[model samples]
Target: MSDGYSLTVELTRGGDSNNRDKMRATVEADTVDELREKVDALRDEMQEWADDFRNIQPEYRRELPDDQSQLGEVQA
Candidate 1:
Protein backbone atom coordinates (compact mmCIF):
# COMPACT_ATOMS: atom_id res chain seq x y z
CA MET A 1 0.00 0.00 0.00
CA SER A 2 1.00 3.67 -0.39
CA ASP A 3 2.19 5.87 2.50
CA GLY A 4 -1.01 6.10 4.50
CA TYR A 5 -2.74 5.47 7.81
CA SER A 6 -5.72 3.31 8.69
CA LEU A 7 -7.83 3.58 11.84
CA THR A 8 -10.49 1.10 12.83
CA VAL A 9 -12.95 1.43 15.72
CA GLU A 10 -15.55 -1.04 16.87
CA LEU A 11 -18.38 -0.63 19.37
CA THR A 12 -20.64 -3.39 20.63
CA ARG A 13 -23.98 -3.07 22.37
CA GLY A 14 -25.35 -5.17 25.19
CA GLY A 15 -26.71 -8.52 24.01
CA ASP A 16 -26.79 -7.33 20.43
CA SER A 17 -24.79 -7.07 17.26
CA ASN A 18 -21.55 -5.09 16.84
CA ASN A 19 -20.77 -1.87 14.95
CA ARG A 20 -17.57 -1.32 13.06
CA ASP A 21 -15.98 1.70 11.38
CA LYS A 22 -12.84 2.10 9.30
CA MET A 23 -11.02 5.27 8.29
CA ARG A 24 -8.13 5.58 5.87
CA ALA A 25 -5.80 8.55 5.29
CA THR A 26 -3.09 8.94 2.68
CA VAL A 27 -0.12 11.34 2.70
CA GLU A 28 1.65 12.09 -0.58
CA ALA A 29 5.02 12.74 1.04
CA ASP A 30 7.83 10.47 -0.18
CA THR A 31 10.10 11.21 2.84
CA VAL A 32 10.00 11.76 6.60
CA ASP A 33 10.60 15.56 6.30
CA GLU A 34 6.92 16.25 5.62
CA LEU A 35 5.82 14.27 8.68
CA ARG A 36 8.18 16.28 10.94
CA GLU A 37 6.62 19.53 9.78
CA LYS A 38 3.18 18.37 10.84
CA VAL A 39 4.51 17.39 14.27
CA ASP A 40 6.11 20.83 14.78
CA ALA A 41 2.84 22.63 14.11
CA LEU A 42 1.04 20.56 16.76
CA ARG A 43 3.80 21.27 19.27
CA ASP A 44 3.44 25.03 18.82
CA GLU A 45 -0.28 24.89 19.51
CA MET A 46 0.29 22.95 22.74
CA GLN A 47 2.92 25.45 23.92
CA GLU A 48 0.53 28.39 23.52
CA TRP A 49 -2.05 26.71 25.74
CA ALA A 50 0.56 26.03 28.41
CA ASP A 51 1.70 29.66 28.44
CA ASP A 52 -1.85 30.88 29.10
CA PHE A 53 -2.19 28.58 32.07
CA ARG A 54 1.14 29.64 33.60
CA ASN A 55 1.09 33.38 32.94
CA ILE A 56 -2.51 34.53 32.40
CA GLN A 57 -4.17 32.64 35.24
CA PRO A 58 -5.07 34.90 38.22
CA GLU A 59 -4.41 32.19 40.82
CA TYR A 60 -0.70 32.25 39.98
CA ARG A 61 -0.09 35.04 42.54
CA ARG A 62 1.97 35.14 45.72
CA GLU A 63 -0.26 35.43 48.80
CA LEU A 64 0.70 36.53 52.31
CA PRO A 65 1.25 33.82 54.89
CA ASP A 66 -1.88 32.69 56.76
CA ASP A 67 -0.12 32.69 60.15
CA GLN A 68 -1.07 34.55 63.36
CA SER A 69 0.86 37.64 62.25
CA GLN A 70 -2.36 39.00 60.80
CA LEU A 71 -4.06 38.78 64.24
CA GLY A 72 -1.00 39.76 66.29
CA GLU A 73 0.66 37.51 68.88
CA VAL A 74 -1.17 37.17 72.26
CA GLN A 75 0.59 38.68 75.32
CA ALA A 76 1.66 36.19 77.99
Candidate 2:
Protein backbone atom coordinates (compact mmCIF):
# COMPACT_ATOMS: atom_id res chain seq x y z
CA MET A 1 0.00 0.00 0.00
CA SER A 2 1.11 3.53 -0.71
CA ASP A 3 1.53 6.19 1.94
CA GLY A 4 -0.18 9.51 1.56
CA TYR A 5 1.48 12.85 2.13
CA SER A 6 -0.24 16.21 2.52
CA LEU A 7 1.48 19.34 1.32
CA THR A 8 0.50 22.94 1.67
CA VAL A 9 2.20 25.71 -0.28
CA GLU A 10 1.64 29.44 0.03
CA LEU A 11 2.96 31.98 -2.41
CA THR A 12 2.62 35.71 -2.02
CA ARG A 13 3.00 38.35 -4.68
CA GLY A 14 2.72 42.13 -4.82
CA GLY A 15 3.05 44.64 -1.98
CA ASP A 16 -0.63 44.41 -1.16
CA SER A 17 -1.20 43.04 2.32
CA ASN A 18 -3.99 40.70 1.32
CA ASN A 19 -2.71 39.26 -1.95
CA ARG A 20 -1.79 35.63 -1.47
CA ASP A 21 -2.18 32.23 -3.09
CA LYS A 22 -2.41 28.90 -1.38
CA MET A 23 -2.22 25.37 -2.75
CA ARG A 24 -2.80 22.05 -1.08
CA ALA A 25 -2.19 18.60 -2.50
CA THR A 26 -1.85 15.02 -1.58
CA VAL A 27 0.92 12.75 -2.93
CA GLU A 28 1.11 9.06 -2.52
CA ALA A 29 4.18 6.81 -2.75
CA ASP A 30 5.21 3.37 -1.81
CA THR A 31 8.52 4.50 -0.31
CA VAL A 32 9.71 7.44 1.74
CA ASP A 33 12.37 8.30 -0.81
CA GLU A 34 9.83 8.46 -3.60
CA LEU A 35 7.58 10.68 -1.57
CA ARG A 36 10.43 13.05 -0.82
CA GLU A 37 11.39 13.22 -4.49
CA LYS A 38 7.85 13.98 -5.51
CA VAL A 39 7.47 16.66 -2.87
CA ASP A 40 10.76 18.28 -3.87
CA ALA A 41 9.72 18.31 -7.52
CA LEU A 42 6.47 20.04 -6.67
CA ARG A 43 8.26 22.61 -4.54
CA ASP A 44 10.75 23.29 -7.32
CA GLU A 45 7.95 23.76 -9.86
CA MET A 46 6.24 26.32 -7.64
CA GLN A 47 9.51 28.11 -7.04
CA GLU A 48 10.20 28.30 -10.74
CA TRP A 49 6.79 29.83 -11.36
CA ALA A 50 7.31 32.35 -8.61
CA ASP A 51 10.68 33.33 -10.01
CA ASP A 52 9.24 33.76 -13.46
CA PHE A 53 6.43 35.93 -12.16
CA ARG A 54 8.82 38.08 -10.21
CA ASN A 55 11.06 38.50 -13.21
CA ILE A 56 8.30 39.28 -15.66
CA GLN A 57 6.45 41.71 -13.41
CA PRO A 58 8.95 43.63 -11.40
CA GLU A 59 6.23 45.86 -10.01
CA TYR A 60 4.46 42.93 -8.40
CA ARG A 61 7.57 41.59 -6.75
CA ARG A 62 7.43 41.30 -2.99
CA GLU A 63 9.11 44.03 -1.01
CA LEU A 64 10.84 43.65 2.29
CA PRO A 65 9.55 45.67 5.19
CA ASP A 66 11.51 48.85 5.75
CA ASP A 67 11.70 48.55 9.49
CA GLN A 68 12.11 45.73 11.98
CA SER A 69 8.86 46.69 13.67
CA GLN A 70 6.98 46.11 10.46
CA LEU A 71 8.26 42.57 10.43
CA GLY A 72 5.96 41.75 13.29
CA GLU A 73 2.91 42.38 11.14
CA VAL A 74 1.70 40.03 8.42
CA GLN A 75 2.43 41.06 4.84
CA ALA A 76 1.68 39.68 1.42
The local lDDT score (0 to 100) that residue 33 gets in candidate 2 is 82
> Please, what is the whole-model Cα lDDT of each candidate in the order they appear?
0.44, 0.64
The lowest-lDDT stretch of 10 consecutive residues in candidate 2 is 17-26
lDDT of 1: 0.44
- Candidate 1, residues 1-76, lDDT tens digits: the string is 3764323222222342332222223333445676556545545654565455345433455555666554356455
Go through the candidates in order and give the clash count of each: 0, 0
The candidate that achieves the highest TM-score relative to the unseen native structure: 2
Question: Candidate 2, which segments miss by more than 4 Å at Cα?
Answer: 1-3, 14-26, 58-76
Candidate No. with top lDDT: 2
Residue pairs in candidate 1 whose N, alpha carbon or C atoms collide under 3 angstroms:
none
